[model samples]
Target: MRKLLKILSREWFLAGMLLAVAIASAAPNLGRSGGLLHIDELSDWGIFTIFFLHGIGLSTEKLKQGFSRWPVHLIVQTFTFVLFPLLFIALDALIGRHLPPDLRLGFCYLCVLPSTVSSSVAMTSIARGNVAAAIFNATLSTLLGVVATPLLVRLLLGSSGAGISLGATMLNIATMLLLPFVIGQLLRPVFGKWFAHFKSTTNAIDRGVILLLVFGAFSNSVADGLWTRHGPGLIAMTLIGATVILAIVLGLTRTAAKLCGFSPEDEIATVFCGSKKTLASGVPMAKLLFGAHPALGVIVLPIMFYHQIQLFVCSILAQRYAARS
Candidate 1:
């Protein structure tokens, strides 16, 4: 209890996340879509701002340096698209009879999600890890997910040629994330020094955006009956399942990083990038993959659980890495 208190006081960001979840649960109608604050647009801009700052903070040379780390890239992608999905499939095979069909599909969706772009890079940056490499792998994962996620769904979920016509989604990604990043890269020579000098300020903004995202997610979860309707037993099952999967993935990534003889920085990147699955990408893709399935909300329930769990766990892990540095 004392240790938990010490951590809460020390890592206020994580504490803030808890508070955000509490607030969202208490007033689900307030922060959710069509609510008063209308967090969707705010969250969209927040994402844009974070990536733009990432651009300014990253040096061109560092980008060049990390671009060709093919081994690191390969490992991160393989763990994301291959190992994670395989483990989920294996679990489904083992105990799928006990799992609800909706919940089973939800977990499978969580498994195949791309590594989240913002949080993956955010956590890596917070950990004082290889931010450049993180940016590369995360961005690549998201872009590739447009194809890979659906293809995997067809192969694993046994769908027949369900193509996601995400021309608009791709555009949104470019405008919200990639375009700002490119602009930041272009303006780096001018504001790079300013960003470096006030690095803590940018870090604070990133953390704030993370909190906003947490609030929005929890708010949506509540409005969608993630807690109120799911009942305690199923909620407990989701939490436990997500926890077990996260732990196994974290352990596997850490072990793989060490075996590859990666530097501490690369190891940090590997563990974070490999362990993450992007909820931002997952939710929309879920709709496309299983459209009008009356139980779509239930099918996405596992994603909600995993997203919250990963952020909480990684925040602690990142802080520990920061302390070590």
Candidate 2:
């Protein structure tokens, strides 16, 4: 068990394999059951556990330090809430004509979603940037997204069948995401010391829970014949499109951050934290906002591909910055 854990820790391939297993397990229900598994409750519980653990792991001091610079926060906020969606809308005008209507709408809808929590922090830390700032920005982004993403989608894609009930989505996020996080924060005084002692255990559990959620999501995707829908050309185009968006956003955010008088560290955080989206946030939101359409899956496909691509590229960029520092 320790060896397996070590392997999974060292490489994400093990996580991918585990997810594939989950997909295989759900294969028998294809076509008849519509890709949803009975284990959805377990997955939801895992998501809740991860959220709580994340809240507990946060250091208030770190957040305070990050928010010390108001300009940095504003830049990140604009990138996440404004710049991202504008890019999607531009894509809609430019290339959307050739794309399927649902796919185009899904693409636009994805742009309005929030930043991820764990990876944003990790990437910032890797870049030797303001890790604390990244954490705060991502946390706030997710919290804001519970409202903002849906509201933006409703306004932009409402006519395109983006069935977003903003109130219900906010309630869902509050219950499944924010509520546990706040509870953990409230319990921090009593649990902080013990939490510090077992920090490694907590991190392990966090990783495991994330893997479970990933598996559950991918299982549903596979069961719905996701892999069979797109051929190599579309996949390649989607991947290339994601890379372009990543590069464009990173460059634009970096320039804006520098112009805003942020230091190099804050600049890195702003660029990475601002420019990226996540499958963790995008997938479920897609289902909620756009229904179980194939185009919604396609929309999420670019985002997920963009996510991994951004991680890999930004990891290299972060290492470069760290070396320079």
Candidate 3:
């Protein structure tokens, strides 16, 4: 009990909780006559609410300091937006032919999403690295994901003849991404001070919102019978894929940072922040890009797996970095 309590107090545990919520949400709908809480509406609101809190908690001055180190910022941004997608494309060319088309497309989509805000910042901070840099990169990445993710999908996935609905995707982005971001920016002035003061309370709000989103998405999956589409082999394949990808990205970022002669602080920030993808970004994008099809639950399977794996791995990495520092 004591060990479990200690483990649960970690940031990765919070992320695992979010994943459990997502899995639980889908589990109920797997049964034909299940009576589950259909919390899709709540999830929608939760996303926006989480974004609102994120915006309010942001310190623009801190972000600016991070960005002022322009070379480091550029490296992280390029890794996130450019290099990562290219790697996914190469992977597609190599082995994607053997995978399900939807899964391949989902892999591509996951590659192009943004770095996470909270965990990235937390991990970098724990590593005694550039917390401000993590904050800036993550926030900017999420903001840019509104446009970049859609455009990337249209470019890469569209080339494979599974053309994404650009107009619909944009519209969803406007509603989900822009609307909340704008609201958050507008309300930042009013609640920013309070948000700063009650950081722990606001963190709780973030977790709660994410939990609701997980439940809602999973519940939809259960209702739609997403589980039967998978077999034992596919599950094993997914775990392997996730593990390999996480290892590659983490190693790539670290190697690149070391080659560039980054300070330990900046290297820690670069490696951790650059290697992550945001589930918060992925879930909404899944709904936006693939909402027309019921089968997308299966498509998002890789991303869900990757999300939890990254969190668990990075949590351990962050602690190691902290201990070393």
Candidate 4:
């Protein structure tokens, strides 16, 4: 019982997610209504701010050091961008007929997302891993994802009737995600100290923005009869699918780290960083990528589920690793 409570306390953000979903289900109109404070516009600006702060927090020196560890970086990047997506595609091929089209696409979307930044670093630190490498890889993955995610979606889901326009999607990502990240990096020299001083505030902003995105996406889903269109069975299947994917990725990353002769610290970093996906980036990307589609909410469900699952599982793994270290 104590262990369960500790786990829950550590993962309060997951509870917030549930609350967001419930509120959206009850009053989805709050997210959809347009006024001076439009939710869509707010979500857009929130995404920009999120990446901008991410930029401010990065250390160029650490990033360079992380780059120097080319072998580990390459492995993490390859798994995040290439291997994960192929695994999902294979999963889709095997079980695609059994699942709804939207859910299948959601699985693919979850695969393409970058490794999460804050959580990946936090878990790596907890596990006594190479924190600098975690930071660099996570940051670089987000930047790459701004381009790679959209392109991969176009290639993987274009024929699934998602109506993805590769050019328009790239334009949206570049303007909304990449441009702010670059501006933040440029301004970091001036505001870096201030950003560090208010680290807690920036962290809050990150969680707040994600919750807002969640509320908006789920509200849109609820408004579109998400519950009626898909029964509890499909929801269960998505949960199961997310769990299985995480397990497979975790096993593969650990095995790959061992075979590649990574140090224990580097191995832990690779396992935690490579196995996780970023809901922070995924939500905003979904809005830009699939906003017009009817199943936008459904499309992001797998990512949402996977985020919580990875946190819970990685928390346990981190604890174990720390004990060994």
Candidate 5:
């Protein structure tokens, strides 16, 4: 019991996410209803603040130092951008007809997403890995995803009759994601010290924003009658699929890191960073990408489940790595 409590304390964010999902399921009106503050508007601001704080937390010098290890960066990016999507595409080809169309698309969307920023860094730190390299690679993945995700969706899902407009999707990403990130980066020089001084506070805000985003997303999903469409059997299949994808990616990353002769720290960073997909980024991107598609909620469901699975699984792996270290 004490051990479980300790694990729970370490993974409070995961608990918060589950609670958020429950609340969204039970009382979605809280997030879906508009009054003084609309959930959509709040989520928009939360995303902006999340990225802005991310910018403030970054150190330019450390980023440059991390960049010097190009081989590690190359491997991480290759797994994130290339290997992940291809794996999902192959899976879709085999079992695509078996699953609901939206869920299959969700799996594909999950693959194309970038590695998460804050969580990847946090997990790397927990594992006693190359923290600087994690930050650099995760950040770069986000920037690259703004363009790459749309293109990949077009190339892969174009035939599904999703009517994806590459130009409009790109515009949305630039406006909602890239623009805020750039603004945050520009302000970093002035606010970097203040941000560093209150690191814990900023980290709390990061988690809070993520929770808010999750709540709002699930609220939207519930409002659209997500449960009616996705029955127990479908949910179970999604869980199984997400787990398999994660296992494959984790194994591939570990093997690749070893083959590349990475130091233990770099190997840890590569494996953790390379295996993650950002629900924070993926949710909003889905909103923009699939705007008003009846299946938008369904499309993000895989990523939602995948996010929790990765966190729980990686937390255990991180703890094990820390013990060894």
Candidate 6:
């Protein structure tokens, strides 16, 4: 009983995520944009706060030391930007014609995204990996994502549908996400230490923003008959697809690290950072990029599904790596 309770307690956030989905599915009218809760307005402000908090949480000086670790960085970044996208591109070629358009684009978005900062670093620490390098690559991946994600989306999905304006989306991303991040960094001199003091509070706020976004996205989808349109099969396929992608990436990262003669610690960091995608960044970007495009929920599903899948798998891997260490 105690062991079961402990497991449940640890996964309460995941439970909350499931609860949010259920609520959104049942009461779609409440959380949908321009609905009773005014989620669209709240989400705009919430998006700003999320990026501002990211800026405050990050310290430039701390990541400088990892600059010397170029080989590891090369492998990690290549896997993130290059290899991941190629896999999805090939998948799109093979099965994309059969998949729903929004869902297919979701996979492309998933491929181009940067990794999760908090989870990647945390998992690396748990796995007894090189924490400094993990922190560096994760941060770099996100910052670069502002440009990389958009460019890759245009490259992959330009005429493929979704009517996205690449130029305008870039401006919105800058004005919405990047600009606030810059402002936050400037203020970080004073606010950084203060935020560091209440890390748990800030972390909660981040998760809170995610829940609100998730609720809003799923709510909009439900109102539009997302489930009625596709049914349960799509969700099942998303879970299976997310699991397969994570497993393949995890295996390849570990193998590549070994081939390059990396230490066991480096391999741990490589696999965890290389395999994961960022819900934190992906959610906001989707909101910015898709914008009430009808398929908003469908577009975010891959990362949403991938995010939880990676967390579950990485936790076990982290434990195993810790044991070996």
Sort by lDDT, best first: what order? 6, 4, 5, 1, 3, 2
**lDDT to native, each model:** 0.78, 0.71, 0.75, 0.87, 0.84, 0.87
Candidate 1 lDDT by residue in tens digits, 183-279: 9989999888877988888878877875776576567667777676666777777888899999999999999999999998999999999999976
Q: Model 3 scores what on Cα lDDT?
A: 0.75
Ranking by TM-score: 6, 4, 5, 3, 2, 1
Cα RMSD of all models vs. native, in order, equals 5.0, 3.6, 3.3, 2.5, 2.6, 1.8
Residue-wise lDDT of candidate 4 within 1-325, one digit each (tens)?
9998897787667878888888888887887535223678889889999888887787877787777777888999999999998998899889988988788888889999999988999999999999889989999898899789988887777676357778888898988888888898899889988879998888889889989888887777788788888879877998999999999999999999999999999999899989999998999888888875657778899999998889889999999999993
What's the TM-score of each model vs. the native? 0.71, 0.85, 0.86, 0.94, 0.89, 0.95
Candidate 3: Cα lDDT at 128 = 90
lDDT digits (tens) for residues 149-210 of candidate 6: 88888888868644777888888887888888889889999888888998888888888898
Badly placed stretches (over 4 Å) of model 1 are 1-9, 100-106, 116-164, 254-272, 277-325
lDDT of 5: 0.84
- Candidate achieving higher TM-score, 3 or 5: 5
Error of 4 at 104 (Å): 1.2
Candidate 5 regions with alpha-carbon error over 4 angstroms: 1-11, 33-37, 323-325
Q: Clashing residue pairs, candidate 6?
A: none
Give the higher-TM-score candidate: 2 or 4.
4
lDDT of 5 at 103: 86
Instruction: Give the range of the ten consecutive residues with the poorest summed lDDT in model 5.
Output: 31-40
Cα lDDT of model 2 overall?
A: 0.71
Candidate 4 runs further than 4 Å off: 1-11, 33-37
Number of the top-ranking candidate, with TM-score as the measure = 6
